[model samples]
Target: MEDAYTHKDLAALCSVSETTIKSYRRKFPGFIPVLTRGKPIRFRKEAGEVCLKIRDCFEKGMSVNETLAELGKHFTPRTGAAPSPSPSPARSQQVVSPEYLDKFFETAGKMMQGMAALATAQAKAGQRLEKVEAVLDKLLEIEARNGERFNELLTKVGSPSPDIPPTASSSGDGAPSRETVRARKIVNVRGSEGEVRSYALEKEADKATGGLEQPPGSLLSTPIVIRNDQDEFLGVPGRLPLSGFVEILVREAEEDGASLSRWERAGEAWVFVMDLTGGGSHALYFTATTTPRGNQVALLERLDVDGKETTPQFLQEFFRQVKDKV
Candidate 1:
């Protein structure tokens, strides 16, 4: 769990910037933790707990943007709610009716205005956003932490019964074969919509094995030549047959590179996020999560493309169709 979610990890998971997180900590209390006052890491258990609640609140009715907007409404005291309190009450009271009342009030008012301006300014910074993001990250971190403990217990349970060889999905090789097929026509398995057949592996990348990993697919950014059956260059996603391809690459992809989604073997199928930047359209990229149940796993996901939704049933069929064709 923690292994998969470092600062870089959470950034990728939450789709935000790390620097933004650091900035948030400076503004919001414990938004990001610096336990020993060193470099920051995920908030610990307490903050994590709050995050879950905040996120639940957000997901059920608000988006990050919406949550921030709501938070911003609380960003400052309302009109007449509290005029700027002086840094010190004794000094502040003196200003209320002293010789310097008018001057002091004016000066203090300016100072308060300056500070308020500063606080508001900080809030708008990406770092301020990070503070809010940290709240959300907290939930993931908690779940991740629990997942770690569960895995530990499972590992402690030791290998499966000798009679039961753990039946698990195959791992990937992270390599590309020359036989990579150009847009082999794919037809969507969904009952709705038009043909969406996926191009299967033109040739066997490698033979199947119980524990053998398949070569990981090229990263999402790795450009692929999408051609027609005649092998004519059809420049991804434009013109006839909608031929074109763009690989989605996780910024942290390995040397050979694969999307974070496909870097690990989840279950029966390796996954990748949708390369939805125009050319990468058509080939579905996967995002969402999967739950492991004994030897099998099931994903909770939607298509990576904008304005497209997919059911888990469709996802399973799509992967199967790809695997079978490949």
Candidate 2:
């Protein structure tokens, strides 16, 4: 009977890791015949020599196809038949010809040189990609700064100019002008519903008066409450006109002692970095857009904490507080 070797035994005999031995068995299945398919899988003694031969070919810069061809010249591939008895260790050792050793070493040295060059090329490519990534990050930062500046400009433009006098055209009695009186009348017309009705009423007033009325006060002073189709209070509207229903999350965050920094503006969304009291930080993206029903609302578009995306559930309490406060 031929000597049988477990994977570990074969690994020791071939001076390779057990993982490498298993890889050889997988890559050259026909050449490494299993004597027992059970646990601690045992292979024919010849599998050890085959592993060594495959390793030598690989080290000698031969591709799998080339190694298979070379193997065919040295040993008959197993055909799933019972393996014939292999020669004793001494006899097998003597079978390795001197010409094979010389050829193996010569090819392996060339392969090593080629592998070193490939590694150097890969390192250079990796460095180039890192540089490109850095540039993109810088560009994104610049874009965000620009957007923030643009937002500031828009806010400034929306404000009442100190240089311009009131255009109410007051009557001699110092009473409000006819247009102002008409605009105020339009504003006072209340909808059956509470705040939501007022928002609609104000829009009508704006259209009727040709925007002569001063831009409404800060959201903090005159917070307009909105609701969804389900009649749930969505929160107070923000002053960002372009965004339909912008919420005043910044005010809420600031009240909680969270330091906030404005980041980039992505589309209609403004990204902010909020640093909490616990020394943790989060990326909060607030998207301002008009609802299909023509309501302006700010939404918490996305939230990221410590570089990981998370559900807004973390801020549910904070949001609840904002709603209650409003």
Candidate 3:
């Protein structure tokens, strides 16, 4: 009787993991013949040689198709037992070999096991898919409810309040006065250090105005005033090309002893990475959008200091200096 080797024996011989040997058997099923199909299945002794050859081929970076071609040169692939010749009429009484019957039953059992495993996997996959779909449906329902509530709130905000009496200036024309318009109270403001406080906005405003109150009629008469406090950083002209503006900023930063590490286009924005002389880094993202006049304007969308999302005071000063040169 020919000796056969188990998966472990072959794995030890090849200096490879047992899992790797199993994978090889699965990948080149024809090359590795099973001598006995049972617990710790046994393969023909020649299978070890085939496994070593496969390992060598893999180490050489040969593709599966290339390995298959190479394997065909030295080994005869097992294509299963040839069909028995038809019994001659003169000698019709032929006894079936017990060994052949055993082999037949083992192969059939393997097939049945494979089919059972496949059915189990498919059932588990279907259950997981149903769970995912249920979660998505719930999320969509929540999103729809939130959208409806938001719209209702917007409508309430835009409409004039019936509780407040109409002023003399608005009573004759039946139009809402400026005071009648909803003023969105500042609920919270987040600072550069990520601290959130309700008084932060007022405190910052006081600091900017040196705690002085604006005299009546001295302020702008417009309903809304878009302040240009950081005009040096944000006062880019609409007519200027965004690329040219970026180049100017880069030159200014370089002249200030800061070196640009790299720059790249991220979607519709240009990202600039810079290395500061004080052993730190910063990234600035500049995005361009078309105005109603069909002119492009560049806006600084985001700033990062040393890979963290923060707006340090030094960065503000740096940009102010850059702006002077621009």
Best by lDDT: 3
- In order of appearance, the predictions have TM-scores of 0.19, 0.25, 0.25
lDDT assessment of candidate 2:
0.59
- Candidate 1 C-alpha lDDT tens digits along 1-326: 33222355444444457664444333344333333333444344333333333344455785443443444443432343323222445754664576756797799999999999999888789687898888866864565456555444433433334332323333377543433312221222333567554322212222212223322222222122222335332222321110112111223222333322322244543343433332332224322222232111122233434436556456555434433322
Screening candidate 2 with a backbone cut-off below 3 angstroms (N, C-alpha, C), the clashing residue pairs are 238-246, 244-296, 244-297, 245-296, 245-297, 245-298, 246-297, 246-298
Candidate lDDT values, in order: 0.38, 0.59, 0.60
Question: lDDT by residue for model 2 over 21-77, one digit each (tens)?
Answer: 888866666788789888878888788788889889999998666677677778787
What stretches of model 2 exceed 4 Å from their correct place?
1-233, 237-260, 315-317
Q: Which residues of candidate 1, in runs, are more than 4 Å off?
A: 1-100, 126-128, 131-191, 194-198, 203-326
How far out, in Å, is residue 132 in model 1?
Answer: 9.6
Error of 2 at 250 (Å): 5.5
Candidate 2 lDDT score at position 162 = 39
Error of 1 at 242 (Å): 32
Query: Candidate 1: global Cα-lDDT?
Result: 0.38
